[model samples]
Target: MTDSDVTISMFERIGGSATIDRLVDRFYDRMDTLPEAKMIRAMHADDLGLIRDVLKRYLTEWTGGPRLYTPEKGHPRLRQRHFGFAIGDAERDAWLLCMRGAMEETVTDGAARQDLNKAISGLADWMRNRT
Candidate 1:
């Protein structure tokens, strides 16, 4: 098999759009309910609808599924967009708690889950703008 044939995108391995939606929903749900997520959840608006959709699209595209986020929103520029938020270690850890919980509930495959966790952990850590 060629590289293209052997290489499967995390998006595909994670079950494409349907699973992405589920993961996003679970992530937000965890954030909404978990005490560990209170700090990060407070940074979000009262209504999570918009961010939920945006994240679904972003994760879809980020995992090599489709170009759903960039065409409308332009570059992700994640850190720049998040600059207004004071994301210290506590905030990052809080965010990761929600995300990791979501991943545990959604991504069944062990390798895919680990890969996603590492990538998301890196992203959450990068969002930290404070000491």
Candidate 2:
């Protein structure tokens, strides 16, 4: 089948697990170092190891890759899980800042990066729990 006839998943388009690993690592690195991300960074645990693993699995499944997170974590219930944190517009912006930087660093496909950015931007917006 021609490329036009093929349905490519975001996972494959973005170069799969390797890219995902790099993306998540870069994302957390930004969160850990970027001054702009301080507010959201404060919401995370001091140790990022566990959350790093969780995010990798979640992003893998969310991007239409193999099922890794759901089987272990059940439904993402992302908003519910994050309810303990105070996610506002500023928080979302900080998150997007880190994520966008990570995407730029790891997701090589331009179109895939843009699409993932849009989808993730929406998720970040929806996560806001404050004004």
User: What tens-digit string does per-residue lDDT give for candidate 2 at 23-117?
Assistant: 99999999999999999888889999999999999999999999999999999999999999998888999999999999999998899999999
Residue 9 accuracy (lDDT) in model 2: 94
Per-residue lDDT, model 2, residue 72, is 99
Model 1 TM-score (2 dp): 0.95
Q: Which stretches of model 1 miss by more than 4 angstroms?
A: 1-5
- Give the total clashing residue pairs for model 1: 0
Question: For residues 1-131, what per-residue lDDT tens digits would candidate 1 score against the true structure?
Answer: 67777888999988899989999999999999999889889999999999999999999999999999999999999999999999999999988988888999999889999998999998888888999
Q: Which candidate comes out best when scored by TM-score?
A: 2
Cα RMSD, each candidate: 1.3, 1.1
lDDT score, candidate 2, position 51: 98
